[model samples]
Target chain A: MSEKHHIIQVWFFVGVLLLVYGFLILASGLAEWSHPPDIVLAELHAPVWWGALMLVLGLIYCIKFLPDRKA
Target chain B: MTAMMAWTVPTTLVHLSAVDLGIIAFYFALVLGIGFYLKRFANTGEDFFLAGREMTAWVAGLAFVSANLGSLELLGWAGSAYQYGILAAHWYWIGAIPAMVFLGIVMMPFYYISKTHSVPGYLQLRYGSATSALSAVTFAIMTILMSGVNMYAMAVVMKVVLGWNINFSIWVSSLTVGIYVASGGLFSAIFNEVLQFFLIWFGALLIPILGLIETGGWKGMVARIQQNFPGQDYTHAWSTLGRFQDNPMGMHWTGIVFGLGAVQAMGYWTTDFLVVQRVLSAKDIRSAKMAPIIGSFFKMAVPLIVILPGLLGLAVLPMHLVPASSLQPGQYSYNEVLPLMLARYCGPGLLGLGITALVAGFMAGMAGNVSAFATVWTYDIYRPFLRKTAPDQHYVSMGRWCTLIGLIVSIGTAYLAMGFASIMDYVQALFGFFIAPLFGTVLLGMLWKRVSRAAGFCGLLAGTLSSVTMFTLMKLDHRWVAIFALSPKAQGLAQDMYQALWACVTCVVVTVLVTLVTKPRPDEELKGLVYALTEVAQEGHTSFLHRPLFWGITALVILAVLQIIFW
Candidate 1:
């Protein structure tokens, strides 16, 4: 038999956290890019690309097993 | 964000508004809640100590590096960046990645499948009781002392950044870490550490980003630093590393590669129990192996959080703004870079979040150390010495007790760690004295089954004695380290690295020579302990692309590219 202990096992709390955090960070980046403010968003040199990266990873993680919850 | 109260460390404060205090309070409560909430999973000794052996690679991975990635790391190494420039990246790259990847690729099979609780427990199985006891005692002391150093770092950050009483900050931080760790054990500690890993990124992301933008990005920042520091090229890593005297830091290339990169890095990452215990708490053998691999990836990126701020500070903060205490006759307290950046860049809500990130780092660090101390004290020492056949419940109780004792001892030790020029260097010196010899001993014990119990014990004993003796000699007179460096300034860090390298050599030499003379342990006795004798439990089973070996190789390749690019 093949053996690969994938870390894709169901996570109870962490999964939800990833989903919320990912969505928030990803959305924040998108929002910032789309609607740049004169002053509120000024002085903010935040790494939106990094946030997108975090979001993609987070989405992949959450989407992989979010629907497959175990009792 | 700027409280223009004639800013000075210990006296000057961030003058946190209500929002900042609220965020910090909420963060502390959340951490404690997570700890107490996990008490259900920690009923048994295994659950309490090893998180029921169910740590996912991601969780364990983050916790693995986060254990060391505290304010001490972010603040101390950022200070290194401010003083030494991009060469500080070596600590994260060559100093950590190779050894960490090696642990995942080579050592984890033995560390995981054999099912040892602590590093000393592994030693006991391989080299017998005396060696294990010595390791356990030394490790326990190291963990407590290191935990104390974390405590001191937390206090200093508070005193400098927020202008709090150092003693009050230390006591409060210790109580918070002590409460969670004593209640939930490793489960709480690892969970909190993983949380902290994210928080630190969230908190400190602003400085480097804003600082770079402020200076007109990478090229601009480099130009600024060059202007500020006339002959020093702070942007490059490997180019300046060709010679110690060539660099502003007066460090040699040989010491960087051999002493810091090989011995000190391998010693701490591979052998030290603080980080190892996090990996051991992983869900399974493969996860244990994968944990450090994943940590290795983050470890590569971590310099961004810790080091970038320092570089940013170099290009941004004026020389006069640096505190008089931190600034010497010529040398500036580069240690103030992180605090200075935090104070200058972050505003209101973000400022509180940044402050919490650092506080969380210290808290996580204290928890990591206390948890490690408890495990060694319980598994390696108490179980073997106090009551050999005690109930698992009793051992868990002992672990909790040790957690309290460890935190208390650390408070005392934190007092000792103060006044050092760089917390990073002071910690490196500590690592050299203990970790360098231990790695030498463990390296021989694992790979060569011929290493006898007596040989291991005596080799470790002798190597340790030599490390202390060398330190004493160097402290007493410059004549002791005359061979290593011509001047006292060059002797600063180069001496520690050389001493570690020589001590490691001494341990290896002594262990080898002694093992050759002494009767060897039978192959049967070394059945899962020695590399040659042990069956690779999870080898060739993992998907080649997904396996730790694959990821470890991938990390090394990335590291090489980064080094060359930065060079």
Candidate 2:
């Protein structure tokens, strides 16, 4: 458990960073792609997908190795 | 959020939103914070230099490959893809996988057991002092030069993308990279590298994904590129391996297989300290061996991130964005491929992320080179001759100070790199001149105990000189073409490939000849250093799936399938 705690911190820190940036990009990408001032057909946009990736990765680290969960 | 946001090709603002700027700013702050956070823990030479030598397989493995995921591997190969089409994938596959797997299964045991501080240190132990000294000096210079090249390349990207001052970009990136690397040594740099690795993937991922989607898919992209650039072999790897002129790279299969795969790439993956230092810091021999194997898997897929953008550029980009480059052996302004794709595909916030990825890549490269330069300088150059029997802390201070000195030297070299047309060509020539010969000596020194100390020294020196002479003569071939029957000023991968082959051949021949005349080092003195004299490294006989040999063969098989399929 202690071993996991020590290793988890680095991943957690990176995860938090990614999630913060990722969520923002996702929100913005969704806003831009879905509600653009000029309406366009929905397609696989880069920012939205990439942002979701970060969000999921961030959630994994934050959930699995959350500070409260530290052994 | 705007009324009707019209978009054109971005030259200055880079299409990055305010949120994007904040994201990038936060990343830089976190990186610096990590450096300072680890500073106090790095009091000892070992901690500062080797991450306290308690790293797990994952740490060492990621660091092993991430340290190499530098600006050159990112931008240089992408640029190559733009010019050479799918032929550029060879560098990532055949050029890397074999040597890397070989290093894991065969060489990691010696490297791990010896406890040598640096690659040159091993040469000292095996061959003799003179060989080590020569290698140390040469490596120290090469490492700094590489860092400077990264600095220059990054500055060019910044200037092109953001219209920032080149000097300002160089100084800021170099100083930032130097501070963290000097502060936490390999530890900080490597941890950040793991982070950089993720960021690089996340950042560069958009280009190919969005590109493929926009172009329909792989088949659609191939068809579009064929339609756009008719009569060009733009989508094959192995089929183009027939001859030099068959491929766009003007390189033959022999050059690809022997020169790049055998000599240039092998020299870098197996012998270069920049990558080896990461492997050396592993916790156990298995981890050390497994690190490169794991890295080889990653290495095989790297072309997707770096090369795919250039290929995508062929299909999607308009005529003006993809300029025709007059640069030798290449016919495209592929350097712009990454930035152009980033600007085109990434809308707002992702643009910042993409740009940050590019920045992180360059910074990671700089840190890799500087950290390696610092290690080689302190252990090989400073401790050996400058100040002997110094306190651990004293050497640690020397390392930190030397990190600064290495950066200053790199700044000067950054200016020199600005003069080159293709940075990869220049770097490969350096590998040929320095690394190929060094690999020759190391390969022989490890495999054959009969290789005398004098022979190792003479061979390394002869190898370096011979490579330089070949490069010089290759350049001057245009003048004396009729007399020497020489090919003139070989460009792209072709000229460098042939040059490296000749140099490696000369190095091996000279080393063998010199070794034959000299007395062999006795078996008693060669323990743990020479393969024949040392105890065989069993790797404890793991399962078929777990064995390094198994993974190696699997990797080669996958490579063969990819080649035939792509061909």
lDDT of 2 by residue, B1-567 (tens): 122223222445364468877877888888888898778767787788887776777778788898888877777777778777888888889899998998888888898788887899899899877899899999988988888778877875766666566766677777788888888888788888988888888888868977888889999999988898888786888776675556667666777888888888888898999999998888778878888988888888888898898899888877523322353422235666777777776667877787788788889998888888888888888778888897898989988998888888888887776554566667777787789888888998899888999999998998889778877876665553212212332354677777677777787888899989988888888899988777765756578777767877888888888787887
iRMS for model 2?
4.9
Reference interface contacts recovered per candidate: 0.00, 0.31
Candidate 1: stretches off by over 4 Å:
A1-70, B1-13, B320-332, B485-491, B538-542
lDDT by residue for model 1 over B1-567, one digit each (tens)? 133322345455367756567667776787787778766667788888887778778888888999989988988889878877887888899999999998887888888867998899999998888999999998888887888788877877776777776777777778888889988898889878877887798778877877777899899999999888888887888777566667756677777789888898999999999999889988777888889999999999988888888888888877623332366543346666788788776555556767888999999999999998999999999888888997889988898888998898888888777666677767877887899999999888889888999999988988888887877788788887766443355545677888788788888899989988999988888888888998886566657977788899999999999988897
DockQ, each predicted model:
0.11, 0.37
lDDT of each: 0.79, 0.78
RMSD of 2: 4.0
| TM-score (C-alpha, index-matched) for candidate 2 | 0.92
For all predicted structures, in order, the TM-scores are 0.89, 0.92
Q: Total clashes, candidate 2? A: 0
Best by DockQ: 2
